[model samples]
Target chain A: GDQVKQSPSALSLQEGTNSALRCNFSIATTTVQWFLQNPRGSLMNLFYLVPGTKENGRLKSTFNSKESYSTLHIRDAQLEDSGTYFCAAEAPQGGRALIFGTGTTVSVSP
Target chain B: EAAVTQSPRNKVAVTGGKVTLSCNQTNNHNNMYWYRQDTGHGLRLIHYSYGAGSTEKGDIPDGYKASRPSQENFSLILELATPSQTSVYFCASGESQSQNTLYFGAGTRLSVL
Candidate 1:
């Protein structure tokens, strides 16, 4: 079974628009991490959360451990934001590794 | 910034041949991990290590073996490559206290035929 699942497998946004990505976890998680895999195939860490919300520039993320879900919001989408967004969950009781979601591919056009 | 470097950006191997993917991190983190990225299955953990000389099987470790000979280096080994194992492999490193925040390498693309 997939412990982590992402919604809206693919998305297209126009420049200056805003969109959100969601992740649902079937397993108990204590923390969550969001990543962006750029066009060059490099995975960059976007945000790390502990059952709360954190904002970084045009990107904001929330992790609700109680409900076993997380969300990432993209504001003022840019061409550089076109990439694959993935959310990973940390279940302390499971192991030291984080469980990852299938990911949402975002394509922001100008 | 944390830096993780993986060797052989791309590799092609024949079935039954041995293949090795290497990763080195400069952050001196205590935890290192190897994962494969497939089309529909974002990323699946293959192996991980807590520190030097320690390796643990991850979610899908049947055809993979990992080695952590030092704090900065981790290696994934495939003794007998198969076509089904063709995928992009990524290596990550993170501190023990914040293992969830991982720093990944560019990734190594492996193709087996």
Candidate 2:
């Protein structure tokens, strides 16, 4: 079984639409981090959370340790937003390293 | 902004040959990690370091060796490369083990024949 799983393996959105991606953890996670891998294959950090919500620009993320899940919301999607979104969780029992989800591939089209 | 740079953006090696992937960080972070990304497995931790003179094995450390001789550099070594080991490798640095945000390098694409 996977310790971390992400829903909607893939997604498509209109340029002006909004969409959300979810990550569910089967392990006891204490923190979560989100990253976006661009078409160029460079990964950029999006958010780092500790059981709360965070917003930056058009991106908002929430992590609920009790529920063992996290969500990433993208508002007014743009072509540039098309990429793969990955969420990683830190479980105390899994050492100090993060356990990563398979990831959600997002495509925003005009 | 923290910068993590990985050298030789790409690599090719023959079976039983040795390959080394290097990473350098300018943030002076205490924690650094090495991960390999495959199609279905996503990214799995291979090795990490708490700081200089310390190295720890992660979930998948079977065919990998890590070295952290200083605060600014960490390297992942493969004593005998295999085709199954062919994948994209990433290096990251963080302020702490689980508290701060992590910054990743562009990645190193390796192909073993």
Question: What tens-digit string does per-residue lDDT give for candidate 2 at B1-113?
Answer: 88999997999999999999999999999989999999888899999998998899898899999999999999999999999999999999988744678899999999999
lDDT of each: 0.92, 0.91
lDDT of 1 by residue, A1-110 (tens): 28999988999999999999999999887889999999999999999888889999999999988888899999999999999999998754323688899999999998
* TM-scores computed on chain B for all candidates: 0.97, 0.97
For model 1, state the Cα shift of residue A55 in Å: 0.4
lDDT of 2 by residue, A1-110 (tens): 29999988999999999999999999887789999999999999999898899999999999998988999999999999999999998746333678899999999989
Candidate 2 residue pairs in clash (backbone atoms < 3 Å): none
DockQ of each: 0.69, 0.70
- After TM-score superposition, the amount by which residue B18's alpha carbon in candidate 2 deviates from its true location, in angstroms, is 0.4
Tell me candidate 2's TM-score on chain B: 0.97
TM-score of each model, in listed order: 0.97, 0.97
